[model samples]
Target: MRSSFARSGLLTAGLCAAVALSTPALAQDKIKVGLILTLSGPAAALGQQARAAFEMALKDLGGKLGGREVELVVADDELKPDVAVTKVKGLIDRDKVDVVVGPTFSNILGAIAKPVTDAKVFLISPNAGPSPLAGKGCSPFFFATSYQNDQVHQVSGKVAQSRGYKTLYLLAPNYQAGKDAIAGVKRDYKGQIVEESYVPLNTLDFQSELAKIAAAKPDAVFTFMPGGMGVNLIKQYKQAGLADRIPLLSSFTVDESTLPAQGDAALGMFAGSNWAPDLDNPQNKAFVAAYVAQQKAVPATYAFQAYDAALLLDGALKATGGKTDDKEALRAAFLKADFTSLRGAFKFSRNGFPVQDFYLTKVGKRPDGKLETQIVEKVFSDYVDSYLPECSIK
Candidate 1:
């Protein structure tokens, strides 16, 4: 009887040990997040800043979401759409990321939208919300933490019109975003366009465009060149001795990422966006402080958006209790837009694009004699995209 009782006690102890060993395996189930950014080439600065902020978000969130670990996978798109597509596919198939963030440029976003949506992977863009994605191509599984393509340009138009500029020369890259920028400016600026030029993508020479601007003799020049394009154009503009004579207004042309390289040339330049690094808000303050402490650099709009994207994903993960398989539930949770956004009072449009404030920022000298872009004024309060009418999302 004693031997039988001892065997029963041993078997019970073994069962308890088995359950204890299996519990950790259940706890080890993590939600995978895939981040695809243009981590190389001319846009490397934007991607690097984005990566920093995302890592910051992970750190702030204690590297977990809803008591579950989050596995983050990052990839570089090399500013190539084909490369972006392949990397996104690999993220979905191999990395098995439940959420996908970024491919900063609009061109890459366009290339990957179909595949990302078809795969039903939750795509939240840190930047690059092209018009089609915000309109006819709106997907339930996709959301944009950034504004629509034309948003900042529209704000620039408002700033230009407010400044009493009767005529403006507009320049942008020869791409979809370039066209959208021109269209956006026209929508807000009821002035004569003396000249409009779409320079070739990645064009280094702005002399020809500058000369044309000199001849057209517009009161001001508005441009939408981003990344290295903006750096090159701004330097040439300064070199041509046009910086002081003609005011430069832009969309994403002058920003934190490009401003240091621009030096004093960027000072006094006007650009517009939904976010600025010096925005006065609790969330913005916290994000900026953390970012500066970690990266030893000022955060840009791109960085803010990337950080917000991570927070947005975290909110959804929390809402669904970290279950990534129920995509519909996750999508619904994200649509609720429950996260604390750096862009104050943020919400999504019918098409999943951000409906938020737009501000005019002036590149000015900080107390430390460093060039920085600060918010001059708010242009649009809770602005909705013009393409929303085309979107049929209920």
Candidate 2:
């Protein structure tokens, strides 16, 4: 009887050990995603739109991607590159996330790209695709869901040329993206630049720049100010009485994100984008309806791009059977870009940036008394970034 009792106790102990060992394996199956964005300060709206759309997409997917539960960790970069690196490192080393998304501005992308990709974890940018990344610095693990920094600006430049603008004045915030913006405008614009002025990033007051524009008296003005900066510029430009005289042509300067504050001042303003709320397509119509219903605000390019990023991840994970252990397999899956884009007809260029269409969009008041960007015309079809040839990724 004693031997039988001892054998039963041993068997029970072994069963408990097996259960303990299995628990960790089950936990490991969950997909951890870290979202890093500039969620504070003047540019907060951009990041907020991205975060909201990404969350909305995940919820639409039933809180899972590729049939596996997701653990999402969100961090605010506060528009600081140093802060972004610290938070992203924590997400990588401490949280052990499978992927990292965001940092809405180009400067932050420049800061965190190396650390995240060097660790063999994928980094996807919904916005802020800097030129260096699209060129010689391209990495197998970094993919940009948004257009390269210069592509949208290139669209605006083409618009300026088509509109018969002879002498143009250029303005942008001083940053890597600002430099890229100027370069893109120059690429397609064959006009004489009266003045090329760059203000410090996030500078709200544009009085001095306005005076310069007034003095130069260029036929049209092109700028790339975004977020709160855009809000202030549009208002100040109208206040300075330059709206009617010097037409404002830009990208990211007067869009859905800043239109609420700009109000009627942004009416008839032309901007360049890959997608707009009024884009006529089944996927875009559905997305716009859902976003308007839930968010109660017009969706911006930031929102659409971020939502596309989620779809990209879902498709890649589904292809890999929800496995992230093999980095090369995951990279290959991402390169496939098997998901439908809100912008319609999106495929990854060899350098991991999008090869997609661009449009000339104009801000207009909706029938429902809301301001939104409406598509004017297709600017570029299947537009590949010029830097693609410089990238050795092939």
Best by lDDT: 2
lDDT of 1 by residue, 132-215 (tens): 888888889889998889888998788889889999999999988899899899988998999888988778789999999888
- Please list the residue runs of candidate 2 whose C-alpha ends up more than 4 Å from where it truly belongs after superposition: 1-9
Clashing pairs in 2: none
* Best candidate (score: TM-score): 2
TM-score of each: 0.93, 0.97
How many clashes does each candidate structure show, in the order listed?
0, 0
Evaluate residue 100 in candidate 2 and report its C-alpha lDDT on the 0 to 100 scale.
Answer: 98
